[model samples]
Target: SPQDLTVSLIPVSGLKAGKNAPSAKIAKLVVNSTTLKEFGVRGISNNVVDSTGTAWRVAGKNTGKEIGVGLSSDSLRRSDSTEKWNGVNWMTFNSNDTLDIVLTGPAQNVTADTYPITLDVVGYQP
Candidate 1:
């Protein structure tokens, strides 16, 4: 079901952006599975990387000094422990029919101001 999924990145609440932040453009990204498949096999793998050899894309123009992206999770809550983490877990990507991704930057040399970024995850499966 990986083909049915999409991933994106956003700033964390405490890791917000400063004023006039340099617009961060999504750059060369590689997406692929580390599952039983070899490093560069075809079809047998999931939507690891688009044939174009890129991972993510910027959706719209700069709206402010900040931005956001969405992510998805399969097992909403792992470990089955009653406790919850105070922060989001830095996801380890796997092609186990799950969703995983990374988000980098506030654009280079963004203003020194602090801004809050939040990731709204949806379409999670288990």
Candidate 2:
């Protein structure tokens, strides 16, 4: 393409939350993309790390391959299951606790170049 267009699904293999993270789950999401339809989220899961640096991947609400852990997007909730969105929420942890996050989705206007996307996770404390 002369305009330089690259389409790809942004894969969030893992995201780790630190002990200072709030307990509340995902309260909101902010996405920046060139096309709405071109962007879609999926497979948002988490893993908590203990003081020993051990990680325990939380099971997904859905009982299927990779289904157990993922973003639990709105479409997935309405069409697939009735479970809450907690399936992709960031959980609280003890001292030195770290969260391992994994989020995968489609992206538009991708190009054959090095691009970096940063995910900033914030939640309410309760």
Candidate 3:
């Protein structure tokens, strides 16, 4: 049987537009299980779109106007495949472990607005 997991994000201060701003803490993932489990996360979409479905633009005057989104986590390691979760390099957490999710703004275009992004978490129990 598969164990149930509860994940949640703790909101932090607003993110400033540009790489000069420090990374903001986006989420605190909590895994509920008696045994250890390995997990990895990836963006569900390519670009971070706003509620109006517009790609996020870089912040700055006379910028290139490119689109970008950045997400990261210190607890989770990068995986070779987005759809597959191999126990080898994935993040392993014991029962009730909390993982912090961080996001760094792109160099140029970001605004003072909220952009909702979805992430898929792949977990494996071995």
Candidate 4:
């Protein structure tokens, strides 16, 4: 059975993620975005974007360099494949980071629908 728990807004949407995510102690972010209506397209392009239509770009905190590119749900799932990605050699996100996922492209079947992006916090570090 699914548990019903209320998700508090991360200081309301449309705001910038200046430093970190609002959630307490959550260091890693496992963002799972799913469309309410099926796009039917197997390999459509998707990314995390902001309210201003700008794709949210992530980078290393210390180095201030752009991080690895986004990965698909399937690609992110395959340990063998995901580990091969060269851009980002780590799996972690800073606290209070505001991120949103979006799917686009692949010609047709890319239906215009709402995609609910769910965040799964990992390694609670207070």
Candidate 5:
């Protein structure tokens, strides 16, 4: 695979803290097009939580598949007091985080010039 895939900081908002710092988990991931085909997995570090500690390939339309990279925790708590947003405070949590992805396989069956892949993040609170 070539160095064609890219990772960006997708703004995170509407975050809430659980009773404690909820552990991170990989909810789901979806890829868009063939444009993300040349990327390959390297290594992911930081505060990422790998529930299974194993990454799986998401079955796609053709030979192209979305890879499940995992998820991380971005919940922030008030330092001074127990402040809860009663539909009034619009406090959001933004982290200097990134979605690490790599391309492994080639385009399968689709014939579209460029495919647009989308990665999704889901959080679990307990």
Candidate 6:
């Protein structure tokens, strides 16, 4: 039987608009007895919608205006292109490992508010 995997992220603070936010550490990834040979992680922007079902706009641009995600490890770093996942190489890991993830915002013209985001983890087996 394969064991379950656990992933967690540390709470981030002081994320300002219109700039590259501070990197957030994916504190832990407990890959137990799973048969997965490799794994990859990426982030996606969860744009908010209004009552009329219209996606929220940031200063005249889509919620994803200049939002981008970057994932980095001790050996490699990859960034998504403007809110889209371009697929990263599979990373082999042991029991516990950590990865640094960062989000970049528009260089200018942004408002102060919370922007929802999602992190997707994909695993592969041999």
In each prediction, how many residue pairs overlap at the backbone (N, C-alpha, C within less than 3 A)? 8, 10, 6, 8, 12, 0
* Residue range with the least summed lDDT across 10 consecutive positions in model 3: 51-60
Compute each candidate's TM-score over C-alphas: 0.21, 0.20, 0.51, 0.23, 0.22, 0.46
For model 3, state the Cα shift of residue 16 in Å.
Answer: 5.1
TM-score-best of 1 and 2? 1
Clashes of 1: 8
Q: Positional deviation of 18 in candidate 4, in angstroms? A: 32
Q: How displaced is residue 5 in candidate 5, in Å? A: 2.7
Q: Which stretches of candidate 5 lie over 4 Å from their true place?
A: 1-3, 20-38, 46-126
lDDT of 3 at 72: 46
The residue-level lDDT of candidate 3 at 84 comes to 27
**Weakest ten-residue segment in model 1 by summed lDDT:** 37-46
Candidate 6 has a TM-score of 0.46
- Candidate 5, 1-126: lDDT as tens digits: 432323453333332222212232323222222333211111232222332222234434554533333233222231111212332222222222233232223322322222233332221111
Writing each residue's lDDT as its tens digit, candidate 3 over 57-101 gives 333235434434434434433323323244222333444556555
lDDT of 4 by residue, 11-94 (tens): 234423234332212122233222111110111114334221222334334445432122233323332211112332223322
RMSD of 3: 7.9
What ranges in model 2 sit over 4 Å off?
1-24, 44-69, 72-75, 78-126
Candidate order by TM-score, decreasing, is 3, 6, 4, 5, 1, 2
Candidate 2 lDDT, 1-126, residue by residue in tens: 122212233444333332212222222233332322122222322533322112123332343222112333342332211222344433222212223322223222222222222232322222
- The most accurate candidate by TM-score is 3
Candidate 1 C-alpha lDDT tens digits along 1-126: 353334333333343334323333322112334332211111111222233111223222344343332222222222121211233222322323333222323343343433333232223222
Stretches of candidate 4 off by over 4 Å are: 1-90, 104-108, 112-116
Alpha-carbon lDDT, every model:
0.28, 0.27, 0.45, 0.27, 0.28, 0.39
Listing every candidate in turn, what is its Cα RMSD in Å to the true structure after a full C-alpha superposition?
A: 14.4, 17.0, 7.9, 16.0, 18.0, 9.1
Model 3 residue runs over 4 Å out of place are 14-22, 47-73, 76-95, 105-109
Worst 10 residues of 5 by lDDT: 75-84
Model 6, position 120: C-alpha lDDT score? 54
Q: After superposition, how far is residue 70 of candidate 3 from its true place, in Å?
A: 4.9
